[model samples]
Target: AQSVTQPDARVTVSEGASLQLRCKYSYSGTPYLFWYVQYPRQGLQLLLKYYSGDPVVQGVNGFEAEFIKSNSSFHLRKASVHWSDSAVYFCAVTGATGGNNKLTFGQGTVLSVIP
Candidate 1:
């Protein structure tokens, strides 16, 4: 079994500011992590993911995430954010067991970009 926690319910940042969304997970053995963003009235889009290798993975929109297995964390980061970046971000973990890839999600963090 696995779980995810996003400590922040909401986050606000200036249009050009950088962003970091925290995520923590609980799982035994190897864990697969992902970051997904949902815009207003839009479906969820995969932002980034980590399963193995490099530990750091690139994502769309200049976003990236690093998997720190020892810390059980996979935090999402952006060098600079635009107003369009405002959305609800979710952290998810998928475990493959018995040929089943089950995903567990976080509560989500709503981001607000101010002009």
Candidate 2:
């Protein structure tokens, strides 16, 4: 079974500042990774995903994530953050089968971007 852990429960950043959200996964072999964001009163939106190929993948908006197998981490990074980016971020992982049938999610990290 695979699991994800988000060290930071909450993060605050000033508008226009760079942001990085840490995510660590526990799995024996390569697993599917995903980052999802939830805005106020909205469903979870897919920010980025990693299955194979390039270690670094670009996502919606200015969000990007890098898969570092050695560190068992898939951290999310944004060159610049906007006030609207404030939301709850979740890191999830699934087995080789793919799909959400056996997905495991982290506790989630709340991001607050101040103007």
Candidate 3:
């Protein structure tokens, strides 16, 4: 079985500050990891993804994440955040069964950026 865990239920940050969100996963085989962001009343947009190769993956809006195989972690980071960045972030993983690419999402971390 494949699953994801997001420790933080919500995170608040001031505008122009940096941010980081934690994520962990458990899977039987090689997993495909991804981060998605959703704004108010909108669908989720892909932030970044990691299938293979580099451990670090860059995302839009100055977001990035580093994949740690040993720790089974893929944490998201941003150097500077804007007020528009305030939204909900979800960490997801896909199994290697080679069937439907259904994503298992975490509980989600709500980011509140204060101006």
Candidate 4:
């Protein structure tokens, strides 16, 4: 079975500070990895995605993630964060089986930024 685990349920960081969110996944072969951000009462927006090719992938809003095959991890990083960046982060995975592209999400990590 394929699954993802986010070690931190919540992360609090001050404005203009660096941030890194951890994510680990369990899968057999090459899987589609994605990082999504959800704001208050809004739908999820894709931060980044790793299907193949490059191990490190960049996303919107200055977010980047590196896909580590050996460790089965895809951790998100940002050099600086802002108060507006405060939201929930979720790590997701999808396979090639098709049909709706059902994504299995992590429990979610709520990020709180203090201005």
Candidate 5:
């Protein structure tokens, strides 16, 4: 079975500061990883995904994630953050099988960006 975990339940950073949200997975085989962000009243939006090829993948709004196979981790990072970036970020994992792509999500890490 595949599972995802976001160690930090909440993260705070000043505006324009760099950010990194930690994510770890438990899966024997290679699994599809995703980072999704949910704004105040909106649905979850895809930040970035890692299917194959490169270890690092770029996402929207200058967000990026690196897939480290050995560590079984896929951590999200950004060079700088804005106040708008403050939201709930979720780390999800799904196995590449069957038609139904069911994603297992972490508890979610709430980001707070101070001005």
Candidate 6:
């Protein structure tokens, strides 16, 4: 079955620290992966995505993700952490079977930034 998996349920970090959020996906054809961040009381915002060709895609707010086809994974990364960056990050996948454009999100990873 095709699905998106986020192994980590929560991630904790201090201000000015670096962070890494992992994501894995399964699909029949070339996968389209995405990373979104949501604040405490707001909707999800696009952080990064992977389509084709380039394995690594850059996103907003100094965020970036790498799509490794061999491992069927799309991992998100940040150079430095900030208090504002603290939020729930989600990994999603599209382009599943039957031409479903709807994105399938993982359980989600909550990030807590300690100042």
What is the C-alpha local distance difference test score of each model? 0.91, 0.93, 0.95, 0.92, 0.94, 0.89
**Candidate 6 worst ten-residue window by lDDT:** 94-103
Maximum-lDDT candidate: 3
Cα lDDT tens digits, model 1, 66-85, are: 99888999999999999999
Cα error, candidate 5, residue 49 (Å): 0.5
Whichever of 3 and 6 has more lDDT, that candidate is 3
Q: Write the per-residue lDDT of candidate 2 for residues 1-114, one digit (tens) a residue.
A: 788999999999999999999999998766989999999999999999998999999999989999999999999999999999999999998876645557789999999999
Estimate TM-scores for all models.
Answer: 0.95, 0.95, 0.96, 0.94, 0.96, 0.94
Q: What would the per-residue lDDT of candidate 3 be over residues 1-115, giving only the tens digit for each residue?
A: 7889999999999999999999999987898999999999999999999988999999888999999999999999999999999999999999766959999999999999999
- In candidate 5, position 98 carries an lDDT of 59
TM-score of 1: 0.95
- Over 1-115, each residue of candidate 5 has an lDDT whose tens digit, in order, gives 7788999999999999999999999976669999999999999999999999899999999999999999999999999999999999999998866536889999999999999
| Candidate 4 ranges with C-alpha deviation above 4 Å | 97-100
Clashes of 4: 0
Measured by TM-score, how close is model 2 to the native structure?
0.95
Which model is ahead, 2 or 4, in terms of lDDT?
2
Give the lDDT of residue 86 in candidate 2: 96
* C-alpha RMSD in Å of predicted model 4 compared with the true structure: 1.3
The true-versus-predicted C-alpha distance at residue 109 of model 5, in Å, is: 0.4
lDDT of 6 at 21: 94
**Against the hidden true structure, what lDDT does model 3 obtain?**
0.95
Weakest ten-residue segment in model 2 by summed lDDT: 94-103
lDDT of 1 at 90: 98
Greater lDDT among 4 and 5 belongs to 5
Question: What value of lDDT does candidate 5 attain over all alpha carbons?
Answer: 0.94
lDDT per residue as tens, model 4, 23-89: 9998776689999999999999999999999899999989999999899999999999999999999
| Model 2 ranges off by over 4 Å | 98-100
